[model samples]
Each structure stands twice: as C-alpha cells, then as structure tokens.
Target chain A: MIAQFPALQVVIPLLGAPLCIILRRGALPWLIALLVSWAALAMAATLLSQVADGEIISYALGGWLAPLGIEYRIDTLNAFMLLLVAGTSSAVLPFAYKSVAKEIPQDRHYLFYSGFLLMLTGLLGMAITGDAFNVFVFIEISSLSSYAMIAMGRDRRALSAAFTYLVMGTVGATFFLIGVGLIYAVTGTLNMADLAERLPPLYQSRTVLAAFAFISVGILLKLALFPLHLWLPNAYTYAPSVVTAFLAATATKVAIYLLLRFGYTVFGAEFVFNIVPASEVLLTLALAGVIIASFVAIFQSDVKRLLAYSSVAQIGYIILGISYANVTGLTASIVHIFNHAVTKGALFLVMGCVAYAAGACRLESFAGLGKRMPLTMAAFVIAGLSLIGVPLTAGFISKWYLVLGAMEKGWWPVAAVILATSLLAAVYVWRVVEIAYFRDAPADAPPLSDPPLALLVPTWVLTGACVYFGIETSLSLGFAEQAAIQLMGGG
Target chain B: MKHHLIPRVIAKLTIPGILLFALYVQFHGDYGPGGGFQAGVIFGAGFILYGLVFGLENLRKVAPPQIVTAFIAVGVLLYGGVGVVSQILGANYLDYDVLSAVDHDGQHLGILLVELGVGITVAAVMMTIFMTFAGRLR
Candidate 1:
C-alpha cells in the first residue's frame, strides 16, 4: 500500500476529474476537486519524506520490467516538484470557489472543475512518470484542458487567448514529441533512465543534438521563456481569474521542471556544458528574458498582464540558476520553483480577489483599493514585496542563493544583473502599490470590500507560506539542495 | 429533400456496421494494432454521419447531449476504477497481475477494461466536441 503512493499521487486526481463531471452539480464538483487536491498534497508530502534520505521509489505499471513498462520514479527532484504542484493546487482551489463563481457562468461550473482536475492530473503525471513519451501525453492532457478552461472565461477575447495558446502549445508539444521520437529512434527505449545511460555514448551524433535542440525550444516555449512568450500575456490576462492564478503558479513551474530534468538528468551536465554551448545559450537567454520582460511589465496597465510579464522575468531567474550547472546554482533553481510558485500564487490570488470585488484587473481599478479592501490589498503588498525580493521573504531567499551561485562561479557581472533585476521588479510592483494606495477612486467606482473569507483565507495561506518558508528555509532549501546535488552528481 | 434521401438511406443502412466494426477494433486491440482510439473515432464517425445525413436535431434526439456528457465521465471512471481495484488487491495501482489468480488472466482483464474505458470516453468526447461546434451554427 505504501509503495503504491507514487501511482496514487497521480491516479487520484485523474479519477477525480471524470468524477466531477459525473456528479454534475455546481458545488459538488468543487468539493470533489478540493478533496482531490488535499489528497494529492498529502501524497506529495509522503513521497517527499520517503525520498528525503535520498531513496528512490520506482513503481512499474502492470508489474512489468522498468525499461519495458511505464514507470513512476520518485527522487528528491520530482518529489519536491510533486509537493509544489500539488500544494499549489490545494491552496488555489479554495480561493477558486468564489473567484470562479463570479467570473464564469453558473452552467459551466462542473466543466470548469473537470478541466481543473484534468490539468492537475497532467502536471502530476508529468512530474511522476519516468517514461519520456508519457510526459508528452500528460502535457497534451493538461494543455488541452487548460485551453478549454481559458476559453471559458467570460471575456470574448478569452476565445482568442485559448486559440493562440492552442496553436503555440500544439507546436511546442509537437516539437517535444519529435524530440522524444528521435531519441527513441536512436536508443529504442522510451524510459528516461535508460535514455540517460544510452544517450551519453551517442552524444556526438547530430541526431541526438537535434533532439536536444528541439526539446529545449519546446520546453522554453512552454516555460514562456522571453522570446517564446508572446502567447502568455494575453492568455493569462484574458482567462478567468482562478484559471490565471492556477496556471501562473503551476504550469510554468512544471515546464521548468522538465527543462531541468532533461537538461541535467538525461543530457548530463558535462555533455551539455562542455560538448555543446548549451550553458552559454541558456545564460544569454536568461539575461535577455529578465531585462526585456521586466521592462515590458513596468508599462502594462492591466494588472494581470503585468504579472504575466513579471512571470517571464522570474522564469529567467530560474534559468539563470540552471545555466550555472553547479550544486548551489541548481539548488537556487530548484528552490525558486517552490518559492516563486508560492509567491506568484499568492499574488495572483490577491488579484483574483480584487477582480472578484472590483470586477476588473486594470491598474486604474486598483486606485484607492488599499483603503477599500485592506486585507486583500495587504496580501498583495506582502506578495508584491516578495516578488521584489525584499528581505525576510521567499523571493529574497532564492535571489540570495542565485547571487551566491553567481559569485561562486566568479561571475561578478552576473551577480550585478541579478541585483539590478530585483530593482526592476521593485519598479513594476511599486506601480501597483502607488495606484492602490495613493490615487483616488473614480467617481463611478462601486463601494468594494475585501473578498469573501473563502478567497481571503487561501490568499493569506499562500502569503503566510511565503513568509514562513522564507524564515524557516530548511524544508524548501534543504530539499532543493539535496535535489540539486542529485542532479549535479548525475543521479 | 428528395436528393437527400439516397444519402440518408445509405447512412441508415451503414451505421450499424460501422458501430460493429468499432467494437471489433476495440476488443481486438490486445492482439492487434487497433485500439480504443481507433475504435472511438470510428464510433464517433458513425454518429457524425447520422447527424450529417438526418440532421443534427435527429442525432441529438438519438444520443442527447446530457447522456453523451455523462458517458465521457463514465468511461474515464471505468478506466480509473480498474486501477483502484488493482490497488485494493494489494498490488500497486494498475498492477494487473493481482487482478486474478493467473497473471496472464489478470493482464487480459485489466487491459480489456482499461481499453473499454478509453473507448467510451474518447467516443463520447468526440461526439461532444462535434455537437458543441455544430450547435454553435444554430
């Protein structure tokens, strides 16, 4: 029973999705989703503990041998990701109850929950599976459901957003499939561990190199890394508030997990850095993404779009950590996966609350909101501070590790870029703060209050986690370090 | 209207055969290339042909949106339920060897059930998507 935890972690949510539709009631599906999320969270926590001492749990489907069967392999890295993905969903679903109700029509409520659960299953399945092709299948499942959920947003533009995402996402997924197919064509095995062993010997082959390039570009697009990020801003901005919050926090983080998994685990650090100029390319892109995206974020009038661009910049920081290819650097990347998810989840949930109360997410809509919705606005401020990497917050801890990683590499300029970007982050965050606190509300502004406790509680839960994880640091940082060591040590 | 009669008659005559072939493809998946996905598409195509020939209103009357929506869930649940049953049998999830006394028997049972689940869901979802898109025209 205990050994089955790895499979149950994904299967529970996969089953819950269809169950939501079967029940066919508005609130019942939400209730089922909430329960499924908590169950997944508990499963993730257990998996993390099991893997804490550096043990790996491998469950073979249908009791077949691993190379021949689909495997759910758990180690420090995926376990940590499982915790992040599941934990974020658990936190976001409570807030989703109110925000979704307000944003989506009553009739489609069950469909929304079904889509949400399907997305959850996809993320969890992607993290858990050891078969490379399985990741593509799960990615499609999640991507398709997300398109549906995004299109369900009340705004007519939501349809275009979904369509755009569908186009970009299909291209990305196709590239990924092509890469996986190429690797399988070369190695004749789809299991990741087998590929890791088989790939190094074929590292010099052009076919392998092409496979790597395709996979990297596919993952970068999915991660919305800078130049490939055109589809994101509109998708996040136009999607319903709950959908925005959920995707903002979990989707890109999962994509980053794939980037790290393939780059370090499958490709091998020595081959990636020494054989190819992959590190240099990653470093260049990360720097560009941070600078360009942050500059763009500062000018956006729509708060959701602003945060969407901010998400691109934040992803740059994660890639920067990965580009270093050291233990501390990878730890920074791994830890930021959790820290950023919590921080961004809180910020987006706060935005959802504002949208719930004020009925818009435009910057002007936030004017004088600090007085009208103090608790909700305060949650935003705390989360925004974290985003700016203020001291004593989750964001600061990741940035600190990122800088230390840079200095460890004797890249002083890289460290400077890190700090400069924090200030850039501050500029964009302050733009909202000034609008919410200083400017007067418009004459036609409806009298607004803090969102219902259903929304506020989850927002603060994540907000409080941002500070708690920042101060404690042991859990997130500890797991991240262990996972980083495993990746760098070529697990 | 008179011109439509021939196509509608052909569709009515051929629909049962398409459905029968779909079932054959679905059940034959364990030993052959055909599987739930192929079967599901065939099943969906049969209904789509009915709609195209007899009109969508007639098709909806035959299948109905509510039941088609429910079938989607039922299919997935059927698939997932098999996994849960394996878990209950004291093996890992989807570990079909525990489903019966003979290991091969369990594998057969597990694969058949899961494929059935997949077939049902895919067919229903395909129909749903077609209806949603076509319904928008009205």
Candidate 2:
C-alpha cells in the first residue's frame, strides 16, 4: 500500500470520476470528490516530505524500465505542485456544493461535478508525471473538461468564451506535442530525467532550440501570460462561480510549474537564459501585465472579470521572479505558486458567496455587502490584503522574495517596478472595498444574510491559510527553497 | 460474402494505402523522429471514416465506447505492465533486455509491445472522444 502511493495519487480521482457519474445523486459526488482529493493531498504531503529529505520516488507503470517506458518521478519540485493542486481541489469542493447549486441547474449538477473531478485528475496527473508526452495527454484531458465546465455557465456568452478557449487550448497542446516530438528525436526518450541528462550534450543543436521554442510558446499560452491571455477574462467572467474558483486556484498554477520544470530543469538554466532569450521577454511582459492589467481591473463593472484580469497581472509577479533566473528568483516563483493559489482561491470563493447572497457579482451589486454579509466580506478583505502583498500575508512573503531577488541581481529598477505594481494592486483592491463598505445600499435591494456555513467554512479556511502561511514561512519557503535548488541544479 | 466483401475489400485496399504510410512513419520514428502516435492517429482516422460513412450504429455493433474505454485503460496498463515484467526479470523498470527468453531479442520485442500499446491507446482514445462528442449531439 505504501509503495503504491504514486499510482494512488492519480488513480483515486481518475477512478473516482466515473464512480461519481455513476452515483449521480445530489451531494454524493461532491462528498466523494472531497474525500478523494483529501486522500491525494495526504499522499502528496508524504511524497513532498520524502523528497525534501533528498529522496526521489520513481514509480514505473507495470514495471517498465526508463528511456523505453513511461515513468512517474517525484522530486521536491513536482511534489510541491502535487500538494498545491490536491490541496486546492479539496478546499474548493466544499464550497462548490452551494455555489454549484445556485449557479448550475439541478439537472446539470452531476455532469458539472463529474467534469470537475476529471479536471482534477488531469491536473494532478500532469503535475506528478515524469514523462514529457504524458504532460500533453493530461493537459488535453484537463482542457477539454475545462471548456465544458466553462460553457456550462448560465450566461450565453459562456459558450463563446468556451469556444475561444477550445481553439487556443488545442493550438497550445499541439505546439507542446511538436516540441515533445523534437525532443524525442534528439534524446530518444520521453522520460524527463533522461532528457535532462541527454540534452546538455546536444545543447548547441538547432533541433533542441526549436523544441525549446515550441514548448515555451505552448506553456506561455497555457499560463495565459499577458499577450497570450486574451481568452481568460471572458472565460472567467462567464463561467459558473464554482468552476471559476477551481480554475483560478489550480489551473494556471499547474502551468507555471510546468514552465519552471521545463525551462529550469529539463533545458537547464544556462540554456534557458544564455542560449534562449527567455529572460528579457519575461521581464518586459511581466512589467506590462502588472501595470496594464491593474489599470484594467479598476474599471471593470463585473467583479469576477475584474479578478480575472487581476489574475493575469498576478502571474506577472511569478514570471518576474523567473526572469531574475537565480536562487532567490526561483524561490520567489515557487513560493508564489503556493501563496497565489491560497489568496486567489479565497478571493474567488468569497466572490461566489457574495454572488449567492446578492444574486450578482457586478461592482454595484456589492453596494451594501459589508453590512449584509459580514463574514464573507471580511474574508474578501483579508484576501484582498494578501493580493496587495500587505504584511503578514502569504502574498507579502512571495513579493519579499521577489524584491530581494531583483535587488540581489542589482536590478534596482526592477525592484522599483515591483513595488510600483503593488501600489496599483492596492488601488484596484481599494476600489472593491470602497464600493462594498462606503457606497449607499440600493433602495430596492432586499435584506440578505451571510452565505451558508458550508461555503463560508472553506472560504475562511483558505483566507486563514493565506495569513497562517504568511507568518509561518517554514513550510512554504523551505519547500520552495529546496525545489528551487533542485530546479537550478537541473535535477 | 458480398455484403461483407464489398466494405472489407474497399477497407482492405484503401486502408492499406493509408496505413502503409502510417507504418512508414512508425518504423521511421527512430530515424527521423516519427512513431507510434502519428501511426495510431492515421489508423484511427481510417476506422473513424468507416463509422462516419457507414453510420455510427453500425460501428457500435463492431466496437462500442465501453470497449474503446476499456482498451484505453488496458493500453496504458499494457504499457505499464511491460515495465513490471522487466523488473521481475531482474532489470530496472522498462529494461528491455530482460524481456527476452534470449538476450538481444528483448529490445525489439519490448519496442514492439510499447508501440503496440501506444497505438492501441491512441486509437481507442481518439474513437472515444469522437463517440463522446457524437453522443452529446444526440
């Protein structure tokens, strides 16, 4: 049973999905998904603990040897991601019940839960798998389900948003396939660890360069980095509230991990920074995404859309850390991967609670939410403080590492730019707070109460995590540091 | 014989032309970087075209989604299963030399099974996706 932990990490949700669909009763699937996700989280923690102590767990499917067979390899880097993904999924499931009921019709609820579970299975599999081609397979499984989940929104525009996402997602997946094909040609192996060993010898080859270009572009599209992010805002806005929360918390974080894994580990830091011009491109885009997305977020009428755009900007901070391309920089990127997931999950879950109470998430809909739903709004406020990187929040720790990394590189301008972006974040988050607290309530609005405990508990759980992890850097920063060292060392 | 013969003949002749190209790429995989995935897709496309022209009900009679899904899992299982066998034979996971009753034969046999597994999984999943979408429309 202990030896099977790696397979169990994926098999639980992968098998649990069809079982969820078969059961098809109200609340049952959600409960089952919650249990399975928590199981995965526990497994992930054990794996991460093992890896942090310098152990690598490689589980072969059916006992096949590597360089010829598929492998699931767990190191500090992937184990951290496995924990982030599974942890977020379990947290989001409790909230999904009420939120899904309110937004998705009863008839479609079972399918929605099924899709959610399948998406979880795909994401976890992607994060944990050691084979490069397996990543593409899991990515497609997740993307197809994601498109379906997004389109299930009651809003008609959800359809078009899903369609646009499909087109872009397919193109991205294809690009990744092309890159894998090229790598396979050069190294004759699909296992990532083997490729890392084989690629450095062929570092000067044009073929490897082509593979890097394809994979980088593919991952960039999936991460929804600034220029390639056109499909995200509408998709987030139009999705059912539960779907948006799940994706915002988990999906892009997986993409960022994939980017870091490939760029730093598989390709090596020297090849990434020296041979390819990834650093400069990442820096320019990070700055633009932060400044432009913040300005855009301030003006949005719809709250979900505003947060969606804010997500794009937040991704910039992660990329900015990577652009620094050093130990502190990599640590910043990795730490933020965990911190941002907590902050955004809390914020979006709170948004869902408010929408459940007020019947809408438009900025004006929150006119008097401060009084109507004190607890949920407080969660929002705490999460907002995290978003702005206020002290004693997880967001601040990620930013501190980022700023330190920039200063270490003697890039004072970059450090200044990061500080300036935090100020812009303050402005947008302040706009939401002012509307909720200070504006007069709409006269016709009926009195409302706080969201049911089922939703609020998970919302506060993540908000609590945001603050807890902020004060306790031992786990997040320690895990991040070890992972960064592994990444920098090309392990 | 005529009823089965006509479709079989058309399939045998035309499908071979298409699959001939697929096999070319599958074998050329090691040399020029093409392999099981492309070959599998091409072979699956032939079956899909058969279903489309001959109606899905007819296709389902021969190969259903349940079977396809099972094949998908089994394909992965087969791939994984091979690795376990190698380990039991006193080698690391996927060490093909352990695969043979004799030494050198193991590499070729291992590669064949791996590719066969890839081809099976790819084709099955392709058909499964098509069936799922078609079912949604209905």
Candidate 3:
C-alpha cells in the first residue's frame, strides 16, 4: 500500500474530480474537493519523505513496465514540487469555500469545485509522470478546466481573458506536442529516463535541436516568461480570486519544474546549456522580465492586477535563478517555487478576503484597509514584505541564494541586477502598503473587517509560512539544495 | 423539421440502425477496427438525429440531462475503478491479469469493462456537448 503512494498521489484527486460532479450539491462538492486536496497533500508529503533519502520512486500505471506503460516518477525535484502544489491546493481550499461562495453563482459551485479538483489532478500528474506525452495530456486536462474556471468569473472581461488564454495555451500545448513528436520520431521513446539515455548520441541532429527549441518555447509560454507573458496578467487578474491564487502558486511553478526536468534531466545540461547557448537568451529574458515587469506592476490601479503583474515580475526572478545554471542558482529556483507559491498564494488569498469583504479589489478598495480589516491587512502586508524579499521572509531567502549564485558564477552585474529588482519589488509592494496604511477610507465604502475565520485562517497560515520558511530554511532549502545538486550532477 | 414527414420518417428508421451499429462496434473493438471513440460518436449521432427531427425536448424526454450527466461521471469512475481494484488485488494499477483466476479470461473481462467505461464516457460527453451548443442555439 505504501508503495502505491506515487500513483495514489495523482489518482485520488483524479477520482475526486468526477466524484464532485457525481455528487453535485451546493457544499458537498466543496467538501469532496477539500478532502481530496488534503489527501493529495498527505500523499505528496509521504512521497517527499520517501525520496528524501535520495531514492527515486517510480510507479508503473496499469501494472505495465516503465517504457511500455505510464509511469509516476518522483525524485527530490518532483517530490518537492508535489508538496508545493498539493500544499497550496490544501491551503487554498479552506479559503476557497468562502471565496467561491461569494465570487461565483451559488448554483455553479459544484462545477467550480469539479474544475478545481481537475486542475489539482493535472498539476499533480504533470509533476509525477515520467512519460513525456502524459504531461501533455495532463496539461490539457488542467488547462481546459482552468479556462472554464477563469471564464466563470463575474467580470465580463473574464470571458475574453479565458479566450486569450485558450488561444495562447492551445498554441503552447500544440508546440509541446510537436516537440514530443519530433523527439519520439528521432529516439522512439517517451519515457524520461530512456530518452535521457537515448538523446546523448544524437546531440548534433537538427531534429533534436528543433525539438529542444519547441519544448523550450512551449514551456516558456506556459510559464509566462517575459515577452511571451501577455496572456498571464489578464487571465490572473480577471479570474475568480481562488483561481488566481491557485494558478499563481502552482501552474507556473509546475511549468518551471517541467523546464528544469526537460532541460536538465532529459536533454542533459551539456546539450541544453553548452550546446545550444540557451543560457544567454534565458538570462537576458530573465533580466528583462525582472526589470520590465516590475516597472509595469508599479502602475496598476487594481490591486489584483497589480499583484498579477507582480507575479510576472516574480516569474522573472524565478527564471533568473534558473538561468544562473549553478547548483546554488538552481537551489534558489527550486526554493522560490515553494516560497513564491506560499507568498504569492497568500497575497492573492488576502486579496480574496478583501474582495469578499469589500466588493472589489481595486486600489481604492484597499485604501485604509489597514484599519478596517486589521488581521487580513496584516497578512497582506507580511506577504507583501515577503514579495519584496524583506529579511526574515521566504522571498528574502530565495533572492539571497539567487544573488549568491550569480556572484558564485562571477556574474557580478547579474547579482547587482538581482538586488536592483528587489528595490523595484519594494517600490511596488510599498505602493500597496502606503495605500492601505496612509490613506483613510471613503465614507461611501462598505464597512469592512477581517473576513470570516475560514478565509483568515488560510491567509494567515500561508503568511505565517512566509515568515517561518524565511527563518527556518532547513526543510525548503535542504530539499532544494539536494534537488539542485541532483539536477546539476545530471542524475 | 418535425413537421417534415419524409426526413423524420427516414431519421426514425435510421436512428435505431445507427445505434445498433454503434453497439456492435463498441463491443467488437478488441478484435476489429472499431472501439470506444468511434462507437461513441456513432451512438451520439443517432440521438442527435432524433433531436434534429423530433425536437430537443423530445430528445430530452428520452434522455434526461440528469441521467446523461450521471453517465459522464460514472463512465470515468468505471474506468478508474478497474484500475483501483487491480491495485488493491496486489497487481499494479490497471493490471488486469488478476481480474480472474484464469489469465486470458481476466484479460478479456478487463478489456471489455474498460472499453465499456470509455464508450460510456465518450458517448455521454458527446451528448453533453450537444446539449450545451444546442441549448445555446435556442
């Protein structure tokens, strides 16, 4: 039974999705989603602990062998990703129950829960699956559901946002499909380990090169790296608050994991970095994403949109860490996935609580919220500080590693740029903090306070995590360092 | 369309034939070219033909949205349920060798059940899609 943890990690949520639809009711589906997410988190924790000892756990689906059947492969990298994604889902659900009730139509709650669970299943499956094509299938499952969920938002613009995402996401998925096809065409294998073994000799082949290009671009679009990130802000801004929180935390992080997995494990670092000169292009883009997106984040009037742009900038930071290409840089990237998931997830969640209590999430809505909703505002401020990479928060730790990584690589300018962006982050974050604390609420505004305990608890849990992880790096940093070493060592 | 006698009569005769063929294809998938997806689309087309000639309300009467919705979830459950059962029986997930004491019999039963699950989901999902688009048209 314990051996089946990897399979159950995904299957539990997969089953819960349909069960939500089968037992469609107002709260029943939410209960099912909540339970399923908790179960997923539990399984993810077990898988991570099992893999912590440097053992790779692979479970073949349908009792078939690895090359023949679907495989759920978990190592230090994906096990940590599993924990991040599942843990986010678990935290988000308690908040979602209240958030969804307010944001979505009462009758459509079951549909929302169903889509939520499907998205959870998709992220988990993508993290765990060793089969390349299976990731495509799970991406579709998660993507299609998210499109629907995003479209469910009350704002009329949500429809267009979802449509834009649909177009971009489809093109991205199609490119990914083409990449997989080309790889399969050349190598006649889809399993990651087998492909890793098979791909080394064909490093010079143009087909393999094109496949790498396609795969990189596809994942880049999905992860919303700069210049390819036009679809993300609108999608995140207009999505229901819970959807925004969930996707912000897990979706792009999983995409990053995919990029690292393919670029490091399957393609081999020799071919990916040294052969293709991927480092410079990725580094330039990461720099651009960090500086430019942070500038954009500063001007947004809607707090959700502000946070959404901030998310784009943060993705820049994540990529910057990745583009460093050293173990410390990779560890920074890995830890940022967890750190950003909790930090950004908490910020969006607090925004949801604000939106729930205040009717809208515009800049005007947050004015003087520091007084009106003390606890929620405090959570927002803490998470905002984390977003700014303030010391004793999770964000500070990642940036520390990122800057240290750049210096280690003798890229002093890159290290300087990383520090400069932290100031920009401070600017954008302080914009919100100043608005909330310095201004006074208008007389016309609805009287507000901290949201119900349900919303507040989850918000604070994640906010507390931002501080806790910043102080205690043993768990997050330990796994990240281990995963980074494995990745850099070409395991 | 409902008032058009010739097309309606033709549809009435052809619908059952289409359905019979769909079931045949659905069951014969293991040995032949037909399988769940092909059979599902064919089966769905028969009902779509009924709605086209007889009206969607009539189609709804024949197959309620509630029941069709149930079929959608149940089909996936049936498919996944098989995998879970195999896992519980000490085989890998979806490994059907243990479905029965006799090895070949287990394979036959497993594939049959799995195909049935797929056939149900595909057909029901088709109906659901039609319901959504056709509902919008009205």
Q: Identify the candidate with maximal TM-score.
A: 3
1 against 3, candidate with superior DockQ: 1
Tell me the deviation in Å of residue A129 in model 3. 0.5
* Complex DockQ per candidate: 0.79, 0.11, 0.77
Model 1 agreement with the true structure over A1-491: per-residue lDDT tens digits: 77888888988999898888889675999999999999999999999999999998899986776899998888999999999999999999998888888888888899999999999999999998999999999999999999999999878999999999999999999999999989999999999898999999999999999999999899999999989999999999999888888899889999999998898888888888998898899999999999999999999999999999999999999999999988989999989988999999999999899888988899999999999999999999999999999889999999999999999999989999999989999999999999999998988878999988999999999999989988999999999999999898888
TM-score of model 3, chain A?
A: 0.99
List A-chain TM-scores for all predictions.
0.99, 0.99, 0.99
Sorted into a CAPRI-style docking class, model 1 comes out as: medium
Best by lDDT: 1
Question: Per-residue alpha-carbon lDDT of model 2 for A1-491, expressed as tens digits?
Answer: 55667777886677667556556677887888889888999999888888888678998765565767778998998899999999998898888888888898897776787788789989998998989999999999899999999999878999999999999988888999999999999989898988988899999999999999999899989999998899899888998888888899889889999999899778889899998999999999988998899889988888899899999999988999999999999999999989999999999999889888887889988888888888988999999999999999999999999999999999989899888888988988888889889987889989988999998999999999999999999999999999999888777
Cand. 1 Cα-lDDT: 0.92
Which 10-residue window of candidate 2 chain A scores lowest in summed lDDT?
A: A15-24
Task: Give interface RMSD, every candidate, in order.
Answer: 1.0, 6.0, 1.0
How high is the DockQ of candidate 1?
Answer: 0.79
